[model samples]
Target: MAKAFKYGLKGIRGHLEPAERELLRSLFDDVISMLEPEERANEDPLAALVGLDTDAREPSDRALRRLLPNVMKNDDDASLEFRRYTERSLRENKIGALKAAALSLDREHLVLTPDDARHWATALNDVRLVLAERLDIRDDADADNVHLMQDWAQAEDVESYLALVYNFTTWLQESLVQAMVHSLDARR
Candidate 1:
């Protein structure tokens, strides 16, 4: 079992069992793989260096679209134009956070600095978002239904297993956010 993260004298700290740590690391890696931009064989060096993807289009994957949403919801042209200029950097930033969070999972004691907390929060949220998409949790009602699957013994299918993972990540993220709030309050 993983302990909920809490803010205290030393820092924001928590404990994860070996299995929990492995699970989190795997989740983080999955999200990182999804966020990584594809390499272009004959791409413009200058444009790539400047983080511009001239041929960038909206992601076809529902989870990816959620991660990298349009700047303008109703206007396709504007959104594509903006994505071409910004999506690369956005993907890189997300991947960086996911990697950092995964690395932290290797630590014996889960003690996080403020920056690490932010990264962990980001990584966990991203994992939850992906899981939610897979679990078809489109609304509060859908999420509530999934949340009903609380027992590991009840995980008879892949959906049930995913729901359990989603619920775990949601709980973890919530605890992290609360600890972050406590850290902020302490600094005031």
Candidate 2:
């Protein structure tokens, strides 16, 4: 039940209830897990469809594919080759962003320096993207339907709660971006 984000002179400022903060921490933890390189090779057939298995290395998960898209979609050989060289570094950058988000959550009040704000924006967008996929949110209309259904959705409905969180994060990201833009404009 903390206020939504707003830009401050120092950085972005906001507040989140302890429970909300914990939820965010959990989300980042899950993302980190998903981004982790699998010990065994990917067994997903969908990877083959995308020609992600062209190389000897394991293909990435669908979520990872969304996060780090192909460098060359038309040429399977080039795309897989590029992925092999860059996927590790991309994963590392995502992990770093998630870690930064967790560090921000450690504070009582949410305060983000410029660097921290960038990390939060990156991490939060990733979380939202994953959640939206899980929720099958195709467009604004689908998202609106989710909100409309909230009136009938029970408090115990996990799906409903997740949708609420997705919506909340979307708003937070939008607000943070707006604040940053305002700050930049002010300096002119």
Candidate 3:
């Protein structure tokens, strides 16, 4: 079991059992792997240094597409053009957040500064997005269906296991958001 994150005198605090920590770290790593852009040979070093990706195209994977959505839904050419310029940086930023969150799991106790909280929140949300795509959770009804799989004992299949994971991440992210809100309110 994990304690819900809370804002207090020191900072945002929470506790996860070792197993929970491992689970979160694995999730973060998986998302980071998915977001890492492929290296292109013969690419201009100057263009790469400035976050330009002339070869970038919309991701074929459903989850990757969700993570790196088009700037304009209805305009394919414009969207692809924009992605060529921005997708690499977006992937790098997401990877950075996921890596930071995964590294934080090495601590026995979770004590988060505002920046850490922001990273955790982003990483968790990305994990949930991937899980949701895997679980085919497209709407409120789909999420409700997945949320019903709360029993670990009943996780007899991969989909059930993913549902349980999704539900757990959703709960964790909600708690984080609540703690973040409390922290904001405390400053006022």
Greater lDDT among 1 and 2 belongs to: 1
| TM-score on alpha carbons, each prediction | 0.98, 0.82, 0.98
Q: How many clashes in each candidate?
A: 0, 0, 0
What is the alpha-carbon lDDT of model 3 when measured against the actual structure? 0.93
Kindly list the per-residue Cα lDDT of model 3 for residues 111-130, writing each as its tens digit: 99999999999999999999
RMSD of 2: 5.9
CA-lDDT, candidates in order: 0.94, 0.77, 0.93
**lDDT tens digits, residues 60-155, model 1?**
999999999999979999999999999999999999999999999888689999999999999999999999999998899999999898999999
How many backbone clashes are present in model 1? 0
What is the C-alpha lDDT profile of model 2 across 30-51, one tens digit per residue?
8888877555465555664453
Model 2: number of clashes? 0
